[model samples]
Target: MASGDLAVGVVCLSQTVVGLMGNVSLLYHYLFLYFTGCRPRSTDLIVVHLIIANFLSLLSRGVPQTMAAFGSTLFLNDIGCKLVFYVHRVGRGVSISTTCLLSVFQVITISPRNSRWGELKEKAPRYTGFAIFLCWLPYMLVNIICLMYITGKWGNTNSTIKKDLGYCSGEGNNEISVSLCVPMLSMPDVFCVGLMLWASSSMVFILFRHQQRVQHIHKNDLSPRSSPESRATHSILVLVSMFVSSYILSCLLQVCIVFMDNPNILAVNASALISVCFPTLCPFILMSRVSREPRLSFAWIKITKSPKPIINM
Candidate 1:
């Protein structure tokens, strides 16, 4: 790398790290406050889990790329390639699974008692951990092909397109090039999209139903601004909504990465921008939930200020 190129890389890397690290630190502090002092609710558990997921996502996807941006370019040298990529793949896979679990858990949590899903809702906390575990299964198993196919080889004009940052796979003259494309090209993206939709839809439906019931029950007595359940629901919904948006951006960016195969700095810039910023949003999403004060002040007072009930409606 030339001196100017190295200088630019350093600035880019420093900017990325500073932004993400600051947000991540805020996430940790809020998590500590919520876990140690705040009310012990199941929602707290899910948020905590989301934080963990975000941490791993940063470690897996963000760290390596950041390092490559500022540090040495030629990494994962023959053996290191598989190791770095393998660890990073597992991290990204865990991130995807965690988001899926987040959606499912919220759906189950908000389901009505009269609904058939009530039984499943009760099982949510117990199974949340297990569901997160289950999510890692496919990503890990299928990504074995990455280890087999990828190596530390530079791509001149002759190489397969890459999706992930600091992730060079099926590049250069590799034995697994022809072997891996069938599964890589079709299966993974389809599977992720399908599962993401299924999880998100179920959650949205349950939340919508819950909110409608709340509004109807309190009809014309709308003196109270909001309910605790409504506020909690809103928080989770926003968090999941952010996840959904990030996932869409990630998928599209990956597609773009594949489409712009040739060495164009514009493609590289857009792709890098997405890859670097993706995981960073996870921390911000969590922090956003914490910073937003509960909208249901009356509901909170119902429990906290039980001695005094001011009737207006």
Candidate 2:
């Protein structure tokens, strides 16, 4: 193997390992809380879902891609190809949906008593369970088309077009599938992105009002640590920004993967490297956010009481 390929393989391996460990640690932490009779907070449930999706995504996409990068060609079969791509897409969709739900849930949690969404805050726990459960339907349905067309390179042979030997390729005359599948796959994402942005905007407004109140009440005590709400607001904002940026970058790379007829190994390697960052970084980001406040930090709060109450609404 070339030094460059070895380097890429090393990076992919490291990312997959780190991401899996981080997410698994978080999962274990939450499950421990639940098993000990500590009632898991609604936000804990959401975090669990997010962690599951990211872990699966890393496994399906990162593991196989890493193996391939390291010169393993075992996944040249139709079933393996189908399974890898299917899991990756489904996990990606679930990750996006749960994130948007998280943003909306947090926004509702912080709603003013007089606000229309104030009533929603109380029922958010139930709604979160429902939302995360239902979010899989659209993504699952859309990716079903993948089983029909996506397969090993041999299955991609057609009279008009040739397929890449390096990656799974779909049927040649798949215009109908492309027309239907692309929109089905993307529509949920578009809607989720919109919802996340709307919630983030509302959060910004609330934070502004909160800041005004804080300044008026304690003008001399300008420390940011005085308010856990501000710390949470900052954390969520950072999470939202990171998720959006990573999601957009992945989408663009996928577009390139789809449109580029003669993609070189370098392009493929670059895409794989960039794609893993979101899942790899997400758990650490959550850890960092949870560390900001002691009372609400992950340290003192067991399963019973979450410091920030992310899903209170």
Candidate 3:
């Protein structure tokens, strides 16, 4: 293998391994909590869904890119390509949708009791399962388009115009199909991203107003400890900001790939790397949030010193 290919392969491998480990660890913790009869927070369910989606995204995108980088060729057949691409798209869609749902749900959870959204506070957790089902259902149905357009390396040999995606190829001969499919796939993502941005902005404004109130209430105290709501909001904002940055950069690289007559290996590798950043980082962010919660410590047991009988040491 070339030196550059070796480097790309190593990086991709490291990303896949680390992402999978983080996601699995988080998943196990949540599952353990559920089975052990601990009552989890309302957002815990949503976070679990997010972890599963991230796991799928990393496995679908990272593994193949790593293999291709290490100089593997024609390893997958038509069915394999279709399945991999479909799973990746589904995972990507669900990740965005779940994040949006989490943000909106938090906004509802924290709204003032007299406000319109306040009514949802008691009812939101009841509908979390339905909301998650909705997030997965549409994406699973919509991304079937991938099955039609994608093919393996050995398939579609006669097609003169195709987009090479390392181990798989996208047949782009029909202009009409390309035009229709691209928009159909992208519209949902754009809509979800818009919702996330709106939700994040609302959270920021709410936090600002809340901080002002705290400062006013504690005028003499210079450093008031933040509330749990503030900490959770901050974490979500950080997650959303990271997601947007990575998503935009990945989309730009994909656009470059689309416009180029032949995209270089570097561009393709970079795009794949950027696309998985949010998934890789998401678990760690949430883990930090979980650790900060006083009632939900991950240690599972508290160590306390015992009193010794009256013998002077």
Top candidate (lDDT)? 3
Give the per-residue lDDT digits (tens) of candidate 1, residues 1-313: 5564455466556545754685567666655555334444555554555555555555555555555655555554546667666765665666666665666666666667777778886666666556655766676786776676556644423335343334344343333564455456446545655676776677667667766777766676758565445455565566556656666776676555444434344444455455445466666655555556542343455556666545557
Instruction: Note the Cα lDDT for every prediction shown.
Output: 0.57, 0.75, 0.84
Q: Which is superior by lDDT, 2 or 3?
A: 3
Candidate 3 lDDT over 1-313, as tens digits, reads 9999889889889888899999998898788677544678889999999998998899899999999999995889989999998999899999999999989988887778888888888999999999999999989999998798778896457565467888888665566876787788888889989999999998888778777777766777776677788789888989999998898998899877766656776898899998788899999888877677765343343212224433587
Clashes of each: 2, 1, 0
The true-versus-predicted C-alpha distance at residue 178 of model 2, in Å, is 2.4
lDDT of 2 by residue, 1-313 (tens): 8899889889999999999998887677666656655555567788888998998799987887788778875556788788888888888888888888888878877778789988886777877778888878888888877777667754445544443424565555456766787777788899999888998999999888877877766766666354655666667777788888888887886666565555567767777777678788888877765556353334345644645654677
- Model 1: weakest 10-residue lDDT segment is 156-165
| Residue 129's lDDT in candidate 2 | 71
Residue 231, model 2: lDDT of: 62
Better of 1 and 2 by lDDT: 2
lDDT of 2 at 147: 77
lDDT of 3: 0.84
